[model samples]
Target: MIKNIMQKVMALACSFIFSTGLAFASTQTAVTAQLVKSEADGTVLICQYRTMKKIHFKVLFTHQVCPLAIQVGH
Candidate 1:
């Protein structure tokens, strides 16, 4: 029936809206980590960071070259 079809359409629309909101919300808390491994021995390394929002870097050393921790939007 037409009512049943309309109900299904409304449900689909609500689900889509809810999912899009979740996707945007997730991006706010999302963080990306990067690892840099140096093949040549060096004491100091040059690094550049790029992001949509403000970020801070926490450098962790496991070896000569280690992973970089990135914090977004804070």
Candidate 2:
């Protein structure tokens, strides 16, 4: 009767809601990783570093090897 039709409609409505929620839950966000800095020849490589994903800030760091270790005197 009408109850059967309403039952089906309710089921469909619930399924639609659930499916859309799942789609949003499974949404993919593209995160990019780029080489931020580097030294000549060979030294250090800085990268992703928490990637600023869901975070509001980025981290910066420097690495030196072999040469450039000495701080210039005043």
Candidate 3:
């Protein structure tokens, strides 16, 4: 009975550690994109970039779109 309890406690501790590690690993990041145009009616848009995530350093690249910037926190 004591051994079983100890095993269960160890398992719980390991699980908690693993979960915390994952939670901390997946941090957060801010991404932004802008359109450089010359004309008003219709213009050519250029230059697009996404900021790297703080923890994972993940970046998503795309062209001109509705969501020019996005911020995700884990």
Best by lDDT: 1
Alpha-carbon runs more than 4 Å astray in model 2: 26-74
lDDT of 1 by residue, 27-65 (tens): 347655443332333545433344545433444333544
lDDT-best of 2 and 3:
3
Q: What is the C-alpha lDDT profile of model 2 across 5-69, one tens digit per residue? A: 99999999999999997667533534433333333433433332223333222322345323212
TM-score (C-alpha) between model 3 and the true structure: 0.36
C-alpha lDDT values of all predictions = 0.54, 0.45, 0.47
Off by over 4 Å in 3: 26-74
- Candidate 2 local Cα displacement, residue 10, angstroms: 0.1
Cα deviation of 9, candidate 3, in Å: 0.2
Per-model TM-score versus the true fold: 0.36, 0.34, 0.36
Across 47-73, the per-residue lDDT of candidate 3 in tens digits comes to 333344232222223333333444544
Candidate 1 deviant stretches above 4 angstroms: 26-74
What lDDT is obtained when candidate 2 is compared to the true structure?
0.45
What is model 1's C-alpha RMSD? 5.7
lDDT of 3: 0.47
True lDDT of residue 7, candidate 3: 100
